[model samples]
Target chain A: MSQIIKQEKKRSFVTAPTAALLSLLLPGLGQILARRVQRGLLMFGALVSIVGLLVWRITLLGRLAEGFWPTLFKSLDRAPMFVAFGLLAIAGLWLWIVIDAAKQTNPNRQFGNSIFVLILVVFFTIGWQISEIDLVKLSSDANEAWVPLSKILWPWEAAVTHDTDTVEAGAKVLVDSEGQAPPVPEKTEGEPYLRVSPRKGELSKLDEDNQVIPGTKITVYGENFEPNTRTQIWWSDSIGNEFRPRYQGEYVSVMTDSEGSFEKELIMPYRLIPPSAKGQQIHKVMARQVSQVGPPLPSQPLILTIELIIETIFMGMMATIFGIIFSVPISFLAARNLMSTSWLTLTIYYLTRTVLNIVRAIEPLIWALIAVVWVGLGPFAGIVALTIHSIAALGKLYSEAIEGINPGPIEAIQATGANKLQTIMYAVVPQMIPPFVSFTIYRWDINVRMSTVIGMVGGGGIGFLLVQYIRLLEYKSAGIAVWFIALTVAILDYVSAEIRQKFV
Target chain B: MLEIKNLTKIYPDGTLALDDVSFTVEDGEFLVVIGLSGSGKSTLLRCINRLIDPTKGQIIMDGQDITAAEPSELRRIRRKIGMIFQHFNLVDRSSVMTNVLSGKLGYINPWASLLHKYPPGAKKEAMAALEKVGITDQATKRADELSGGQRQRVGIARALMQNPSMMLADEPVASLDPVLAHTILGYLEQLNSESHISVICSLHYLDLVQRYATKVIGLRDGQVVYRGDREDIRKMTDGQFKEIYGEEAVRVNAGEFDQGEK
Candidate 1:
């Protein structure tokens, strides 16, 4: 030891200039020569990590192009300021390291390790640039999010709708009659009525190319409707499927005057009649107006959201039940304490551990995608994916619980002439109950949260509806789904916490 | 009679915990083993019931070879030889009754026991064991809810449930107070004399050993260094004490044992 110490002392006599030159070649090299090995290694690691992060950011910003130099140049071209900032920081660090290494052996050196603070500042700045953290953009572009965000924040408006009372009036028209056109319907007093000129004509039909062929022109007149009320035109085919007919890219709707009368011209809308029909087909055009609004009722989005949220809850529940059933046995196989007694058991332990780790390393969403492919899209797919992930996760947790149990009782029970299975039952199982209950509840909580997200990959739940609403820019509807998910998760967390307290 | 001939236990790590140990305990003998912490007392006790398989040994109990017993045979032999521990190892989460009942596992139907269906008489027997240990009132309580003395009493009751011919107590009173040590030993003595059950107990204090042991063996570094009967222990010399306890040990209150309160 003394001889090695003497040799180290002799090697530490390098001049300050030489030390500086050595550090200039590579950061921290001179510090190692100066006998500050730990400091030197730390400096080297910090420099490499910072440079690597900077390079990674550049590559990411460079459109992830192939090759380093091209990507770096492209990144520099795209973000000159960030590259310059990074380069300047590196230069500063390089100079500081050189200076520090030169003065490292000098007992009179005054500067504390201030380079660490500088390095931290540089790291933060690089992280800021890499993340594109822009407070200015956040403030300036608030308006774009405001439209959706405001609706999301207060979405009760979409939750309910008022019922309406409709006044209907219709007139029948003939379609390709053999002899003559049908006469106009006679009008009655004190009732809404509609009349058509030359009541019968050939109904519009699609040609071979599926283009509409305009039918004969006709004048339609309406009277005795609610005054100043908007009236919409509806057409029903021979099979009685009613739809609002479009005329020149607009619905055929008009406002009634104070006298409750109006006139409009229309072309008979195209209708498809089955070729198997044996008789002449008649089509009906109706003029409808909503005159009164009634009591409020749940909106369609609200109903659909509730239905899907229930499905999502059940998906989480079914997965958790399946997870518990499979993981309990797997956990025993995976537990090191229980399985370490023999070579065969030890192999089983390692195999179970590896399989669990591989399965758990993959996120449930990825599994959901695979499941969607296997089972097609539905809640069953979500349940399958969540169950797979939960089993792996719960298996690991339960095995850890088993490994952590007190071995004292196990020894005591074994000494009592209990069989191996009996020992586990009386000694190990008793100790494992609290941790098992706690972990199961925790896994159930995670499963519920994951079930909400798996639906985005077409696993049927509220998330499926949520993504669609988001895609369609239906923010209010999406907001309802989001609230339901958040509410369910919060409630589940509380319920699980309460249950854990009672059992664990 | 229990006879151990050429018993040796070398652990997997090559620790010679017991080396060529041999001893004999006649029926109804209250044999107390005296040794330092690592002097093979616990190992010897564990070896007798085959809790730990001896590296090499012959343990003959009433003409039966315990050391060479198969797994099923070993369990059957273990049940007849009850063992209590220093730490009072009761299943803390289980009711005291349940912990006591588990001691009867070797003799019960294995499948019925798996489903926790003890025979109708088993509970009554467990209650009787608890009554003997003076803890019948605590039968329904969780084992951990009891005091140290109470827990040890529960341990004794659990061992009693086996209806064993011989008992192994490994530093049974080491964790108890000085007074409670006598109380626990008194219970063992009563069982030894009144019920005619033999006891192989390890004790630390010389005063306690001299009071309770019908026969005594002292060990050091896994080798027996001293042997004495009740009369030899009462008149023990410092030279013999040093041979077993080493030169560094001091005999506190040498005059206390001469009085012999009983």
Candidate 2:
């Protein structure tokens, strides 16, 4: 009988190689043979679910893995690199499990410690692979970003331009190449009895025959200047120092005609006196061709930054106020103690708590998107979004505060034969006020910070303007917005701290 | 006078806190109930005031059946029955005056109470109650600001606001220091004798029960096992004590009578 028993035992027994081979067939088959039924099932579940997750993630990316064969190849090409990396992670974990199972029939009792190393390896490798972590990208991208980033960090130049045209003039007489004013012209005989010495037809205005006044236009004509070049007419003082007449802010240039000569009416400046000619003023017209020019700075965008910062602060404050109004009563419903007396109350308690949790779980930015759709994009949308999020956060805090108050007072009030409402007024509300004030101030502080994020999603605050500036490549304006936001938040944080300190 | 006729109270969890227990208290008598922790002493006192409804019984005070009182009727009945507690359950956040004034809620107008505006006349009465308990100075202080003895005084003053004819103190001195126990009970004693108000108080120590009880009822397992006047309990035998207090129970002050038997 003993020999028969031994023979039966040998037939049922599993060796290391057999166990390893079994695990190769199915994830936890070897562990099952080793009589670790619970562990085997758990490992099997994990392997199957992780593979299922990988397939799901692949499908979610629109890699339709149709018809097992063609999809097997094409889907791999279409799926993100993460799926392949995930498969590798599972392969590593499975290999570790197979080797571990082969070492003993009855493996280590503590499943977590025994398998922790492989589990960590799987998680980190998949995380690293899926995220496409590449330090080289950061290094290469940093160099490209430095040009704009440095300019943003370095505050912009806002200097005013003060440029003018220089002019000089000298009076000239109408003379021929002999350099002498007309004298007796040629044998003045026939006309000697009755003739004025007449010039040919008429001398041009280039000879300065017209008188000019400040703030009035005068005709100035010139010939033989650079062709098609930008030229400016200047006012020449009696001291021979020439300057352009200021039309609006700076000198306005006129282009020369293609024939290398130009004629135009020019406006006189409001003031034309030079240092040497302060008492006695005289003027002359001079023209020069300009080759290059610069533009005056625009200050419209700078003023816009300041307006947005104020809007962001008010948006946060409004949201916090709305949150407080809605959350105070709702918190009492969520409090476990008040609702513990009846089954109906307990149900309402749990329902209120679940709703709060669900609302809180959704981020304020996502809420902002919904609010933008509802309210049509502005600080109003931001306020509504922030209010919804803050209600959930502050409700949870207030409920916890209610739950934490000592029950002695409540029972004491009840024993006085007071009604429910009286008990709450006399006892519960007092205990709640201090923590309520503190939490409210804290929530307002949080909401102010949240408004910046809401603005990024087009909820209309400084964050909205900040994103616009960055997108439009106006880094200087964006930098100004950042400064406004940082300074406002920091100051509010300190002020709220002092307020909370007083209440607490 | 108060009468508890076959009073039975079963808690919501089906605990038979009091099972067919019956007792009575004459007007102006100090009736002390002695029992173990769960011996139905608290249930009996609460049932008389209908703070806890009896499962099957009749609680009669003066000619009214308290157990059958309506919601509005119960409040009126409760106004006359002042209840004190082991923890001196004053609203700790409220002013001591407010805590005392709440005892007059059953007598005040419901609308006025809802508005939390008590009559000035009621305020004067609450002050008088505080004066009676020697805690008139603590009237404006928050209830939690006082020592245990002072808090119990506040509790007593709150009960006095109703001008109650009977007081139910359920282990009132249980949470007090051993030395301060009699001091708290002394005020209850004065209320019973001088004001002619009946008191049904539960007590722990046998020596205290003997000192203050005009009459005593010993309960064991929610059943009345011993009954006596003040003098009879003072000389109670070990066998009688064991019947209510249980075997292996040696009185802390039992002295030679217990030592001789052991």
Candidate 3:
């Protein structure tokens, strides 16, 4: 030990100028020359990945790529400042590497110098450029963005149509007054409601008692929607409050036929009525072809945001339930102590552990894409993706729980002449229940968060709705959906923590 | 009555844990087996209940060849024989009552057992067993919530629920303190005398063996080396015990055994 310590104490020297030159050529080369292998590898990896990201973005977009290495050749004709910003970050890392390598020759010297302030300044400047930040736009153009943003947050203002935009959006109203509300096939309440076209050019919206079941599919066809515009169909309860009919997610975006007309079917989304609605099921089918010319009724956007948020929450819940179902048995198989008894069992244990690790390593987003392919693009795909991910994650936790169980009870149960199943129930299950519950709750929390983003891959959740609105720059409705996601996540986090406390 | 003509147990790994052990457990006999840790006392006790299948043996208990019994038939035989452990192996997370009621699992319908629904008659009997161990008050508490002595009492209660004709206790008092050890053995002694349930118990201390045992067997390296009645064991000298236990072994609390408690 003393000899090793003495060897470690001996100092090695490198020329500062030579080290800096090496780093100047390659971001972490000087650090490697200075015998800082880990530091060199980290710096090298970060710089390379940053450059790779820039190349990928520029090449994939093709806007700035008439040739290879556009920035190196053209110097200033980039499509977005963010690509330049990414390049700058790489340069920043390179500068840090050179400075750090030079200081390595003198172990007592600090790496940071006055140049760090310059680096910081440049970093912030690039960040601002990439973000396209404009103080003037914040004060002036904020009005245009805020009008829609505020409407999305305070939904009734933009969602409730003062005119018959819902009817004009897609529906052909064949019945009016008494015929619209009652004496139609669907269930009716006290007054008249706007009836929609159930088939092409036919307007008998009601079924038998004038009431549509929660899962009932409604078809709305309309003429004179702006040609090639995307149209949406929504449902509203008695008080003129509208909700988005998001089956899996936002009704797979129907576009109007080039003649400016559309015919589409959408399911009446479940849990559309809040408990506050007091059992009122009198619903109206309305549609709108999204046109560049006019803004939607404030209430329509507001309600759709709320509806999509709730649907995302439900999607997360379903995924968690499936996660629990699949994880429980796999956990027993995966537990080292339970499955390491014999050669056959030991082989199974390693196989189970390896498979679990592989599944867990893949992000839910990638799983969602796979799920979309397997099941088609809907909330079902989202559920399948999150459930698959959740099973692997929760299986690991449950296996840890099984491995931690006391051996005493197992022996005791066996001594009492209990069979394998009885022993597991009497001994193993009791020890496992608390941890199982805690893991399930924790998995549910994670699934909820994953489901929100899963929609981007067509997994049918609020994330799908969120990505579209963000792409269209409709920040108002987007802001409302973001609020719902934030609220749901916050609630789930609190509830899971409380549940964990109880179990633990 | 149980008869062991020639019982041998060789582990899969080739460690001979028991060899050619032969003994008869007469009706209501409190037979104490004494040996050092690796002398195969545990293997011997387990073989009777078939917890560890003997490598070769014919254990005739009440005219039935237990070694020849099928898995389902083995369970029927096991239900008649209750076993206790040194670690008081009660499920720590389950209630004391639940642990005790587990002893009745063999007799209960498998489906009902899966649902953890003990018949009302079984519940009433579990309470009676707890009363016998003087821990009826702790029945609803979790098994681990009790102190070591109390936990052992729960272990006894759980075994008592079986209403077995014979009990195999593998170093039941090994993990307890001196005072608790005697108290536990006293309960076993009382059960042996009162219910006339034959007990084949492995013990550690000389004083405990002398106090509780009606007959004694001493093992050394998987072979039975000495056999004696209560009086012969009580009169055993240090030199005589050395022959059975080996020269390296030391006696513990030997002087305490001479003065009889009862």
Candidate 4:
């Protein structure tokens, strides 16, 4: 019996290597050696299917190429179906290979499957190279050819209406430069020197076809303007009317030449202009200019709308600061190891989680609106909204990190005469630092994205500018704002990824 | 240095783990507690250090009643006594040096320890302890990377780092092979002789206790069935051994004895 047992062990040792070598030559060969013929055949079938699908896709593309653009464009619309089928076939083949590898009894069979997988990987790479598409050129051509007919309408011209030759009350207007108004004194209490122009009657009324179209031009003439003085120009439609302000041609500060002349072309509210009143009525025009340096010269109160770019940047920074500050303490309460009692832990956990869910559930814009009502419209309202949401989200993540720490050191510290606080400081805090830094970076990324959204509701950021542009139907300007936001998010993601990699 | 008076421990599950156990170990005595699995040997050792609170007993160590001490006072008392586990319980991810430095935590202020700002004297003492254990060269290596015997040596160094008056080792060698087990026991014996520190170790192998233990205590079903010197334990009759262990175990030991002759 002893001799027979020894002989069997020796046989296994020798056959194991031999079986492995055979399996290494072809996929499923080891399974065949192990007497699993059905499994081997299944693996073989899967390999054949993958190769067949690749060949079919390549051949179909080749046939389409024979006729070039005509056939290719026709077939391009159906390309998604072919891609989906190819993906399914690939998935099926992979699953079969994995199952066969696992069910294989002999080590030799596993070795064979490994080599087979390696070969297939090389083949798949070659297939991918053959299937590559020139997507870059295609996208560029599409962009160049497709111009919507809406561009021809020139909607900005129809944005305003005015009375005939009479500057009526509440009529949309522009500043008229031809007036020889007196120079308004600096810090003047009453109205300052200003030029007012009516919206032209010719463009104010619709044609016989009944399409509303409007056009107007007004210029500002001023004296004693410094050669480099910066000026802003804006216009507002009738109050309480639904004519939303157009954001086109808004300049931060148009510098006056040495002659004190600043000319700007303004487009009417093309995107958000309200429908013209039933009858033509007079509208007011207002214009004022201020120096970039010192206090504004007592200029007429310009009715032109002002967009505050600096305030937007300030609001975003303040919100981020407060968010980080409030999140720190709440996170400690939520950590499980620091809070030993399960009841206390559960209470804080649920409370923080619920608050975070509620904060995240409402868009930051909604929060900003509510905050504006509470705190008045300013950066303060935006800061409050971001702070509350950050605490909830950051607290949950920080607490989870604390709970996942190795309990050994905590126990060791507790085993000493140290109190609970001391134990946490010595054991829990050290372990939590790497993850905390990582979470902070991620939160910064999230905060930047959120800051843009909150700006739309007067919270003050780039989003507020974006909203103004979109409301005016200036898609090009709106596109610029969107591109900036996307680029910022991508850059932040890359930076945070680099930082996280260091910790890992 | 340590004394127990009629200690008893009945777990919440209604299982009586230790019952009316009593013993005393004088200063510098190398005492070994021996029993089979589930024999209350571990319970008896843990009770001495108050690692597990006894249900109905008093533990008098250095003339103070440790069992009735307040929580803070109990912690203070525990600081003076070092305990080693079978698993070593070293922080696996930390360096061997850090694991040894943790033993000095009981003496240093917690904030100081948290910042890893041990006094120069403490650092010297830690180095000395590591040197005594012959693992000074592996001070910076992670504890998990060491072999079982080397890890156990580091555990001993950590315990010594406490500078405790009494040491308790529970199944310290149960995970080691026979030769390494003997080497560790020899180290423990040497520490006891040189430092005059009272040593109480629980051991599973009967032959091991017979070889190195100056005093042997036998436990059975939570009761101290035998308490005497090693010579007296070896002279116990087959019937007495059968009474503590079952007949099958006594017969097994007898077979081992016969096998040794070969």
Winning candidate number (TM-score): 1
Badly placed stretches (over 4 Å) of model 3 are A1-3, A6-298, A337-345, B237-262
lDDT of 3 by residue, B1-262 (tens): 9999789999988999898999999989999999889999999998898888898879999999999999888888888888888998888878998999999988888889998888889988998888977888998998889999899888888888778889899999888777777777777878889999999999987778877899999998899988999899899887877787788767787334333232
Give me the displacement of residue A251 in model 2, in angstroms. Answer: 15
For model 2, the superposed segments whose C-alpha errors exceed 4 Å read: A1-13, A38-98, A106-115, A139-310, A328-353, A390-411, A487-504, B106-140, B237-239, B248-262
Provide DockQ values for all models, in the order shown.
0.64, 0.37, 0.51, 0.21
Best lDDT among the predictions, by candidate number = 1
DockQ ranking from best candidate downward: 1, 3, 2, 4
Per-residue lDDT tens digits for candidate 1, residues A33-111, read: 8776766787888888889998878878887678877888888898898888897898899899999888875544543
lDDT of 2 by residue, A1-504 (tens): 243223322221477788788888897788677665555676777777677766655555445556654555564676546657676778877887787557546333233345755565556655564576887898988888886677567634421232443221222222111234333223332221111122111222222554433344455554555568777666554456666766566685667678655566545444423335333233345566544335654355556766777788888889999999999889989999889999999999999999999999999999999999999889999999999999999999999999999776665555556667766776688788879989998988888888976899889888898898889987777777777778888998999999988765
Of the true interface contacts, each candidate retains a share of: 0.74, 0.49, 0.74, 0.25
lDDT of 3 by residue, A185-233 (tens): 3423432122443421222244578664445456655555566776666
Model 4 C-alpha lDDT per residue in residues A229-344, reported as the tens digit of each score:
55554444435334323434344235666765445443433323345543333233333354234433322111111233344434545665676677777777766666756776
Q: Over 4 Å off in model 1, which ranges?
A: A1-12, A21-84, A105-111, A160-164, A170-185, A194-287, A291-299, A342-348, B70-73, B237-242, B248-262
> For candidate 2, what is the DockQ-based docking class?
acceptable
Docking quality category of candidate 1 according to DockQ thresholds? medium
In candidate 4, how many Å is residue B39 off? 5.9
* Per-model TM values vs. the true structure: 0.81, 0.69, 0.64, 0.53
Q: What is the descending TM-score order? A: 1, 2, 3, 4
> Which candidate, 2 or 3, would have the higher TM-score against the true structure?
2
